[model samples]
Target: MDYLAATAEKKYLMYISQNYSYAILRPLQQEILAHGGEVKWFLEGDEVNPDFLHQEEQRLMSLNDVKEWQPDIVYLPGNIVPNFIPGKKVKVFHGFNSGKRVNNGLDNHFKIRDCFDLYCTQGPSTTTTFTELAQKHGYFQVKETGWPTLDPYFSEVENNPYEDKQDPRKTLLICSTFSRRISLAPKLYEQIKAFSEQGKWRILMQFHPKMPSELVAQYKALQNENLTFVETDNVLPLLKAADVMLCDTSSILLMFILQRKPVVTFCNQNPDEHLVDITDADKIEQAIDYALTEPDELMAKIEHFCQQLHPYQDGLSSQRVLAASNELLLSNPALKPKPRNFIRNLKMRKKLNYWRW
Candidate 1:
């Protein structure tokens, strides 16, 4: 029996449907290219602009293209994938679960949609949970490969990306989750603008791609000498450059905190010791000021938090993810039968406009 060894002839599909997927899966693309493996992208939804595809990158234009070009495995950074896609589905995950829950209080992050054959988890925080889920589900395997999006974050950026920002003062990255109910972007706009005008810190603000355009515009208009607004598909650059972060509730905050830096969040729904959480918009300034000081207790807690999250900083997570994928193929693990969710599959087919068997 062939073990389906990973070779130069191996073909992989990068299944992405969000703006951030470009950054999350691109490092793995580079690794695939380096190993002489074939990689192609399929941007699933309108939320992902086709123009964002680099000139050198190839994208499958239609469902027919995806169906005909049988790939050995599919790597997905987002939550869902069409069941019709012909490949072993793997979920690399989009972000850490920083306490955002569904209506039933279930973790959206850990929700088993029964779509993936493997999960390349980020660290111990997720690994143990995903492992238990894997045992329960019996149809998917879990591997702690870290996150590929952050590979470049560790190895590529120079020691001083801040100097390039031209700001000696502490840098602040302001971001928020897209939920209207919890987002502090709109409420804290004046405070952020005033802080920027004060010139005590350089402000770098970015929002989720799904963030309402009008609200995003409000912050965009406030850009001045001390503050800059960016909307790149990748946030690692901003993450690397930021000295601290101000936000309400978003996985991006967890991303920044991975550096063991302090984060000031406004009315975080799941406020923990890991964050400098404040209840009022007016309190953001004082909260940020306290964060900038890097209180020893907060710093120490952040250090512990970092270990549970992504502990890898060697910039080789992409390599690990690929290797784990190959291991999965080698094992061809026997799995229990999955439920026939015809309704879900139908929705997926309609979304992609592909119904033909």
Candidate 2:
């Protein structure tokens, strides 16, 4: 029954650009290790801190190193991967489409880049679109394997962070997307400071990795007895600890609401019926109060929305992802050949400085 006793049979490579991938892939890594598989990380982009790699995990430093290691599968959290890389490039996705704007006659979330062989979609919200896209592309397969990142989230023992505090208070988590055009971080500075000093709730502030340094610093200065600013590769714990979330169009909202908690959004791109969305800064205080109370009608809407977003609460999502990958390996190749985008592939090759044919 113990597969861990066997020598690692399959090798998996985690190719990521954001630090968030550490949290996302770690659950899958545990599953892979349990199944007698090896996982190596290939971190690209300046946003990913190499220091985030755990001591037990190994990082393949270069494109050539990845080739030399010869992984059976390369799991990508970002959109694009170099075609020259060996193995089946699988798109695991970093976040759900949090209603970011579509661009250039294309929807950002559903864009079919020619790089991936299989798409491990989160749920029906994404699977339906990707399935149709796969039918159109004829070169990639789509599998509705719930995201691997939420495995830890669904399995972990819930905690109340204020358990030991002399004065117990509600926990509020503030997360903002990095996009200046869509982010509420800058506008929320004054409001957050007022909330911190008000001491009605325990506040946690986490910003996107690419959020402006000055804004991050400004929020950092607001740390006090009631407010705590944390920087971690995993945001799940914060999501678990908070009673309610205060966010703007960040996918973190979708992730939090999946926990069946209320969210107060600030002018989200597509403010659906689920959120306590407010357009005016003055209404934030009122919204937070409503969210914290967890109104029955609002709760019903959130529950319905969560089912549409991510219905898997069993925490075996990682296993499903692995199973999907295995199915791909055992199945026949796509009916049609994968199309090559010279410009995108060229950019990737140049970015990695890999020219070997």
Candidate 3:
């Protein structure tokens, strides 16, 4: 008996970046491979340059890759959809989008949902929100797979290499990025400086991968013995060490939630069109201060928020997502699931109201 026949051979493609996005997609891809499927990875923006494209073409042709590695299924991990190739024999295509809110116009949502053969979501709220929006716009069939990223946390061993030796001074994890769309640097810097001056805590700032060297240098210049910044390919280890997490709208906060760690979302910028309303800045700052000053209160709030945000914050979330994917694959073997009309319509309403355009 052929295992591939029993499990179904799938050619999975994932675009990787050095961030939480990769963390969310990697496990599912691994699961597919473990089940006797073929997986291929394409780095984000990997073949943008003409030189690189030419090299890629030569490599493909030299290896007779297109014919040799005929992909039955293609999986795109994030929202960015690839252009369909003519004459390509892809049997199914799966796309995953994990944003808390939808920023692009309703048409954009429709475009993305319609482009992929199957669509999977991160959380129940996101699923419901997008589903309604798609339905409003006359789309149906978006699958609520929960969040695959949170899966690892469910079963993750609490093996903190730094746990036994954690500095009693209290360690805070600060995650931020440099974005021209919103200037959070000054506000974050001010908060960090203020917290450091108290001499009761130490900060470990994790810069976004796209942040420039000069920007990091400027941050490093302000560093004292109590404040430190490190550039790393991964932040999971740091998240494990942190007593609390400070971040903007980045999805890393979702990871903190999964870990049941205290989190303070920096709401200095206006809410994006696609996401939930802005968390109040004053409230945000107060929350951070509360977490820093009152450990018990922060933990309580963390537990409550985890219950509200994700039903399953433990690491088993990946299994849920995988099961959803398998269901879609089995139910509609010919065409993958796409977002329904309800989500598109709801988003259209939001766009018309100027709530999210």
Candidate 4:
């Protein structure tokens, strides 16, 4: 028997569409390699940086490569898994499912589509929701291994907790979801301008990768002596650098929450009492003050929220996810994940335009 075929180790294929998700999936790749499994990578869009591939350039596979290899498992960080893809389709999810009202909230983030064979949920809330959805929909398996994106926070223990820069100025980070309905950037620009003009704090703005470039340009124009706009694939380091965060329903808030820092969200429909919520644009400054001054009062609630979302601070979620992927690969029925729902996924494909099929 061929060594690749005879060995118990499985082959894993990962589809990373956005650079931001790269860090989230890296740990899983490391774990699979450690377990004697072969790992292949594929970039979803033109945004891929060839330099990032480094020595692993040979491991980068195309859609045709995916068809030829037919790995035992497929991991996707986003919702759409494409039609007729080989292997067990697992949804590792891009971020927390905070139930923001985008497209009436009917997307697969809340509803189950047939393309995913398994859902590796981020926390208790999401796991419970998807577990009920799995039972109700009757098509998939739900596992509550905390999101691998967050594994870095737990596993790579920090020697020093976040500390303010030596400069006396407090730092503020602004992040938002992409939906026009819920995105705070559009609504809060004028206020942001006023806040930045104050010159009291250092401000950094990072947008969702999917946020429109025109809108990003508009925000970039606001940059001044105190405010800076950042466009990057990774937000983790910035999250560590900020003293407070302002966001509206982006799962990125969970990352900041894990650091036990206070966040202020604007126009958030599904509000968590633990977050400082502001409906009035004029109240943005007050919210910032509260986050900077009263974070201690919210520390208990923030910790409670973190525990409920993910109880494990052990940093082994990637190993758990890979282990679960292997178990499913061994026992999952021959049933392939169904094609994307034409009406829903088609519109999304036209909107995002990444999948070749």
Candidate 5:
């Protein structure tokens, strides 16, 4: 029963945790549809916006509907893998390696778990890491398909959707991860404020959707003539329009790096020598100046980094992910690997409410 022979019968269920994740999963959903597969979508969280879902042309579903759909495969943009689900769980991952604090063999995200049936890695770096982990653990399939979220970046859109909407000055897009110790919002608010009010550069700030509401409000209060607070989950257009980016340990920077632009990071835990890292808030302005300068060496480094992280910039990653997933679904049940480290996995599953066994 090859996947190609059963293409029309294949059913895909995408489990999304946040509205922003739809950006990453939607490409793959379209790929599935193009291949004649039935696609069902489920959004998990009380914050799920029905209007946003409708705008994306996706239908809402109850948890019960998931059980009824009984998809052949379930694609997860985030890490959590539900053991209670009927389909084989696949991890498409949330973002590329953007220097987050991940435990190499355990918490740093390279840790092998029995939850996922297959892992679609972004590039050589991740593929090699997961391949070694799979051989060591002997419980999962690994595919080196690039991330689907990057498909739009390589598309021929002529101009950025936000290009005309941005302020006349060069735009400096700032984003931060939710981690308190590494986040730049609390530490550099005044500096950001100074930059925004100076009116030399247009400032657009995008916080992680999970950032504390209070912190979001605090930043919003700082908005002024040249500074705009971007509250939407759709940051792709903003990324396209940005001249330079300032971020701290957020993987979205990896997305920006694809554009071959400069990124100034503040105290990134997993620091890359290529990125301009500023340890002090007082020095952020200097870093931004350096980034906006667009030094040739820095541009080369960013290009190399993007190639290592995800080589194919042809905008077909979604199709690759679908092909790998279909291969897994067509395989025999007995051949499918089971989750290893039973006791540990059981504890994790129970803690995450993924399963109760």
Candidate 6:
């Protein structure tokens, strides 16, 4: 019986985000290293300006070094898949999100689908979408393992007591991803004003990864005594501190759902513009109003949804993710070979043509 520990002596490369995806990748890397494999990390930094080209070239050189070492496998965490590499000699596995309806109707999604050797999704719906894409692309091997991050929440462990303190006054967590495409600032500001006017609950605003520091400062300047803002690398601890989470179409809501905490998703932006299905917009709004007006009812609904959607909310997700990876590695021992190096092959052809001339 050749176990993962014995086989993982081979080298592996992991492509990950320097800030956002570290929480997910760090644990997986640790597991691989525990099994005797050597792991190298290739970090993708925020490319917010013209200097992005230089940063990308430097990163490419790092990747080239990894290629030269010829690792047996490459694992890419969500939204950071490396599709530009020419060789398929190393098996590439992509981890993806499934909470939102419309993800990757853009260029990044297409690149991920076309380039990765294997796809792994967090939600059932996402698995279906990936399966369809795989069939369309004539690549038929994709796996659906529920969101690895949520595995901890679903595990068998004592619920954090601090998470369930039901005071007559509740805390509302305003969560949103900072994207120009859908600036949640306007809607969140409006909700804060309205929610505060009621004076029934405290509000905590947590900014997204891409949010500007000035925006957070400006938000703090308003200084509604009941309002607080959290800016940190870890939002899960904050999520546990919250009673309710309000936001628009980001995967954080799914995390809240795992907690069995009340959630209200805002659909202030044009729904059709994004690929997300917004047919339940009115219901989402109603849920928000219900949470504000009748906390007990909203909490009950959240509990029901959690019972149906997630029966597990412990902190063992990292372990489950490792188990899933081990299962995958056991099922497939042969590494996928990369096609001929595109650039080298092209240069060789050019040299041969010159000699003929």
* TM-score of each predicted structure versus truth: 0.95, 0.95, 0.68, 0.85, 0.90, 0.66
lDDT of 2 by residue, 161-204 (tens): 42334657888999999999889997877898999999998888
Model 4, stretches more than 4 Å misplaced? 1-8, 47-51, 57-61, 101-107, 155-164, 295-297, 333-357
Q: After superposition, how far is residue 124 of candidate 3 from its true place, in Å?
A: 1.9
Candidate 4: the clashing residue pairs are none
Please write out the lDDT profile of model 5 over residues 123-214, one tens digit for every residue.
98789989988777666889999988879878755665556553567888999988888898888888988887788888888999889889
- lDDT score at residue 102, model 3, on the 0-100 scale: 50
For model 5, the superposed segments whose C-alpha errors exceed 4 Å read 1-6, 55-60, 103-107, 158-161, 165-168, 333-336, 340-357
Q: Please identify which of the two predictions, 2 or 3, would achieve the higher lDDT against the true structure.
A: 2
TM-score of 1: 0.95
lDDT for model 5, please.
0.79
lDDT of each: 0.85, 0.86, 0.52, 0.77, 0.79, 0.52
Candidate 3 lDDT tens digits, 37-145: 6655444443222232222222223113433565444445445333321111211112122243355543332344453444566556456766775565443346655
CA lDDT, candidate 6, residue 279:
32
Candidate 6 lDDT at 71 equals 59
Number of the top lDDT candidate: 2
- 10 residues in a row with least lDDT, candidate 2: 1-10
* Residues 1-357 of candidate 6: C-alpha lDDT, one tens digit per residue: 444554366655656553545455555555666677776655544422223222212232354565576655566654334434322222222323323434455423334333355665554535566677766665425655444444434444355423435555577777776664555565456546656666666667777766776767767765575666766544566677776777765656656656655566566332221122223533543555465564565557656654444344554444444444555455663434433355654554453332221
Off by over 4 Å in 1: 1-5, 158-165
Residue lDDT tens for model 4, 1-357: 232222246778877777776777877887777668888887776766645664863455566677788778889987776655678888998777677645664754676567788888878867878888877766688888887777677544454233335658998999988989889978988988887898888888899878988889998998987888987665677787788999998878878888878989998777876799899988889889988886665877888898887777788888778767766766665444454478766665565553665
Q: 203 in model 3: Cα distance from truth in Å?
A: 1.4
